[model samples]
Target: MLALRDSTQYAHMTPAHPCDSDDPERRFRPLSPVETCVDTCGLARDSAPYFSQHNKRYGVLTMANGKQATARRLKMADRAQQLQDLHFPGMPEILLWHRNRHDGFITIPRTLPIVMQAVDAQSKGQPAGHTLFCLWARSPDHPVLSIENPSTFAAEAGFIGERAVDTWRRRMKKLRELHCIETKPGASGEFHYVLLHNPNAVMEWMHSVGLVRAELYSRFIERLADVGAFGEIEAVRQLWAQQQAAEAASAAAQTAATVPAAEADATAQANAAPEASAKVQIALPELGANL
Candidate 1:
């Protein structure tokens, strides 16, 4: 597994958010379940390669026909528009969208690969399993998944179910409704979408949605430090402070430069007035005596 290094603290880390505990109904709602075998378990042959190809090529999978593709795309768009109306009407707009023709799925902007795994529990003569789809963007600095075999996928399933699956579903749905997922055609008649947000974008979007205070963005960065994502939160803090100071200095310089030249001319005239008067008196005395 590729770990994220905290740039500030030099510690291994992961991104985390506050877990919602208040609404049990909302929280436990049947999340988009990962199909063990699409349409039927055990009866359906493992189409892992098909899904893999879809994921690698288009980032999302969808039905092969153009009409169904168009309908799914429209449905996704409608959902996104609704989300935008509900939250994030502005800022960090969706960037790209793509889907695989072989499967009926779409990847939202900024989503990562959905890691599918066999669950420890078996389902009806078939291996019970689920997919761990990443709803949020990982820090680009972190390592992407390194699953080489099905066992690794199984291990990851545990990791994700415990840490990410629920959160992923919630956030993914929210993002989808917000139109944050961009849509486009893929090589094999599939579609692909890239999330528009990076780390900064996530911070901004969080603030936009009232999930966290603007001031908390810094603290969240610090927490990332605590989790070993960066070397130290203090270092990130210092960097941010330094950048602010530099910006302030630049703004001050620009303001100084923008001061009107006429103001400088006025000051110079005021300072020279007494000398000019004295010179005028001497010249006048000389002129009077001559006249």
Candidate 2:
């Protein structure tokens, strides 16, 4: 058997397997569990190609349709047609939200449900999740949105009773406190304009603040990874680390610059003191001789 090192350069090759070595003693060595998964447990037959010797080193497997490699690039109309055929044949294409024609849809993270649960856990008995969703729905594909009518928003968020608007406002405040949104006072009220934050980033911040439960966080991470979006959080963390390192380096440089100047000033003061002392001694001797 041939071995492929666990590297992106050889990622197209069959999952790393134990290679036949010339050393007889090591020939029977078993493959580690991680390396043996493809051979022993196996991937979905439709999704993974069969390993063969002819193309073992050179061939690349085409991922399944709707997999990460092709899903995003697959035309929206094609995807909708595929879904329609599979689930509801003869469905009118005109009714579908085809990308070429639709205009009023909002993009959202796949992990939003998990985020909603996290928010609800932090602010119990409040429709904070509903309010957050409502805000997203109202947004015009932008992070910032203006709520011109609190009463209408309250109704949309399912807040009822005479104080529905008041309840909605409370949830809105909770969302701001959780760092999911930012608000500023405007003509509408205290939270007339709202700025929505990335749900994944907000979840990360909540996790740091001890607001996210470990189990929920695990699920959230898994969902993000599934959607190939976990990198966004990691990228943010890396950027923050880079900023901190830059700040530390800048501070060190300033301290280094200041120390040299401070030492020079001290040396000048010390040298002047000796000269002043010598001059005083000379004056005293002159005065004595004159006397």
Candidate 3:
């Protein structure tokens, strides 16, 4: 027997529950009522067994279908109720922001802090880390962002003074030089369109170029393993190798195709030479007889 207050609050369904009914209105009809009690109630239906109002509370006395999924849902419902109980009076049920709700968020790599450290270690004076963070904040959960206004971005990146924009540009250049980002010329400037690279790949590149310190690289690897992202570096490398192989195969095929055409042309030209000589001999008179 299940105690259900609201259909939306539980997901246990008896084996004979008409959950898959073609008639949407008749969905979730209880199988066989042992005792009919009631007042018709209006409630949002989800995945609950059909129930009736009993003493102003909705209740259903039925056996669950005994599915593992159903059990899991029951446990989840309990956990959700527990969390809801923690909500205090006068406070909204949801205080934290989530991606599911709306915009005003950016998703970045979990290993971003290590990547930033690696970037800063490359140049002591420049604050490329801050610039990178600013770029990420401005992005819409994508790798691309436009930096149209230099002064505005400079301020956002914590740069100040008369040369603040210049300072910001230098850090941008540094990021590009390290392969953390790629940029293109636009109406704004050289870095008007910036395409951020995966920081994990950038870290791997830095390690290859000796830009990342050994200790930091070790930590980065460990953190990646912890977060199940360690394979991304090797995955990127393998993808690059596959691309190179494909390009080489395409170029070789093109060369082979051109060589066959050239050979066929040469054969045709050779065969045509003898026929032309024979025609010339047939057209001319014998030299001695003509004299």
Candidate 4:
């Protein structure tokens, strides 16, 4: 049972005794729930009964029908009462809501949708995006829907049809031209788009194209990092550390070069002061003698 109240006062209100669905209509805002998986997954949801080897936080749950399922968040207060009560015995607030996974193929990455629907989450090889994307890829039976195949990517991602694929592919070409992505030749004469790895560069590019906001861009990058995307995050951090070290070394060298010049200038000033004083004394005595 879910309930709703004023957003400001929602925290103070006591939980109603299992009220009917009192949640109101959603505000006029588009929704995104999925996230790009990280290398490490946190504790599993209270509702889920199983766990995945890779995603230690939660295993893909087995439903009544024995179909392995993943978690999807509800737009409304799926578990508001639990959080509001402050007495609910369960996992942390982050894993409060235990809802069904959204069923569909997604073209966009996780952290955007927060919803995924699939039979098996682990198949083919893992990639940097959603650990779920591993399951979302083209299976033999589901071959028609994979992103690698264009048509599937279009449909699942909200594109129209085969025609949409050509348009999107063309758009990808334009994006490639802009250097947002790189298109490399793959087997079977197909082209694969390698996403740019730099989060700052990606954010700037997305903003320039009106695709993301500061908040969403940050969230997107965070989720991408979670799922081991952009290669290894540790590796990226290492590179950043190395760059900082190089810059520090350069600054130190520059300071060292200036120190010698500064010392020489000081020494020259001290020597010149005695010579000037002696000349002034000698000139004054000669003028006195002549007078």
Candidate 5:
């Protein structure tokens, strides 16, 4: 029954674009759901990707099984192996540094132990569940679910010119295609949804499951539960639910312009997926203190 310092206020404290929490030039994309997509926007992954030996950009290691892969790709894989192995490092500094700055929650990335405990005590067989709404969906494991506005969701987490509604349903559609963080229903449809699958469903059919970060996220939450932090997790959930209820119409569109982090504070409240399948998983690390 450990309490989480009444973290209900954490939501209101974050800046509009937490991505800008650190580097102004580089907007840290909300955590990758499972693994970083090899091909997409941002730093275009060449069709013939060049694995760097000392890729200082992300500090990616280039040697795995004598082959080369991006550090971004390996981070996800490392997380998966760490979970099954149960080595509690006690803070996600790597994640925060990669994203650019302090998360406002902790000076250091909290080791997955406490987080894992909190998640388990709450979710009832549902993946991530209410707790999902509590933690930052922009973490390394969860990543940004969808920045796209409602219009994007309707188009199957895509753009019409771009949009969606029936938010949860759209989320499900997005989930089935890629492996990413569990997203909320509020995306206004004009933003970029950090999804694992191609935002374009038809494209997903031709492509492959995007990011499976959700699966890992679910597992991670459960781990957090094992260590007795459920109460804190619940407090976060209650606060978030209240915020969502108050802004039902506009909640999905909490983008930079619409929800400016400053005014957003006055209004209060806020906000992955990773990379691959077999080899690695991405986004925020999953919870499972007792696994």
Candidate 6:
């Protein structure tokens, strides 16, 4: 019963449910009852009287035909629900839960539409799941309707639904923690746009989290040099060098401080040996005089 109800929540009914249906006139109508019965009954002399039975149940039927109809409706609803959950779960409620007046069907939520050209440029052998999330995170303005060829992406980075969701969640969390990205509430007050307009913001955040490798950093500097951002790159490089030199100098000073005081101990031993030698000579003279 719960399954049926859940399935019907998103299902498209000819006469939609009271909650979803917009027509105030039909909203008060009572739900129609469903019935079931056996068709054939046979009687023989050996067998007692055969009787046909009718199921007088009032709610929706649960027989084969009814189940099929329910299943079909549920499948469509489930797909729509999945897409909704991925793109626009609860935000910008105005656009997400809108009903089409023409066909009385609910349309899919409008995500930050990614264009095909951008997808073609970025979609290179990455998993569909990763590609989708990456597009959402990196290129929200350019939404990819469909992949031209999904095979390479599926083969290389086959991130499925759960893994993809987790990965994107972690990325967003990191971005927020570093203050590289900010979420602005949509007009509807339910949806948000993840903004990444500042390139340096992300790079700095990545550096803080140790996400940028040395080689990659060097490459980034080179690219900056190609343009006119060399001054900024050089400043960063100088800071790194200063830090490294300071650490090295501190380590050298610590090493010198740890050396043992061997020279002072050796000098003390030499002075004590001379005094002992004199004492031995004096004792020898005293013994000769007594004899």
Q: Number of backbone collisions per candidate, in order?
A: 40, 0, 0, 18, 79, 11
Which is better, 1 or 6, measured by lDDT?
6
- Using all chains and alpha carbons, the TM-scores for the candidates as numbered come to 0.24, 0.59, 0.53, 0.30, 0.17, 0.24
lDDT of 2 by residue, 117-140 (tens): 999998886749878988998899
Query: Residue 229 lDDT in model 3?
Result: 62
* Global local distance difference test of model 6: 0.39
- Greater lDDT among 1 and 3 belongs to 3
Candidate 6 on 98-209: residue-level lDDT in tens?
4432333422112112111222223234312233344343343432222223333333334446365444444334444444445555542211455542343334335446
Clashing pairs in 3: none
Model 6: lDDT of residue 149: 30
Better of 3 and 5 by TM-score: 3
Q: Which residues of candidate 4, in runs, are more than 4 Å off?
A: 1-201, 204-215, 222-228, 232-234, 286-291
Output the number of the lDDT-best candidate: 2
For candidate 3, give the lDDT. Answer: 0.69
lDDT of each: 0.37, 0.70, 0.69, 0.40, 0.34, 0.39
lDDT of 4 by residue, 1-291 (tens): 111223434322222111111233212112221222232343221111111222232211112211211222331254666566675666575664433444444344443232221101111131122322332343233312223565655455345754866644554454344333454555412334344323334433443465554445444434444443423333554576799999999999999999999999999999999999999999999999999
How does residue 18 of candidate 5 score in lDDT?
Answer: 21
Candidate 3 runs further than 4 Å off: 1-103, 243-291
- On TM-score, the candidate that comes out on top is 2
lDDT of 3 by residue, 5-52 (tens): 345323333212332333533333443222122324332121122322
lDDT of 3 at 118: 90
| TM-score for candidate 1, residues paired by index | 0.24
Off by over 4 Å in 2: 1-80, 94-99, 242-291
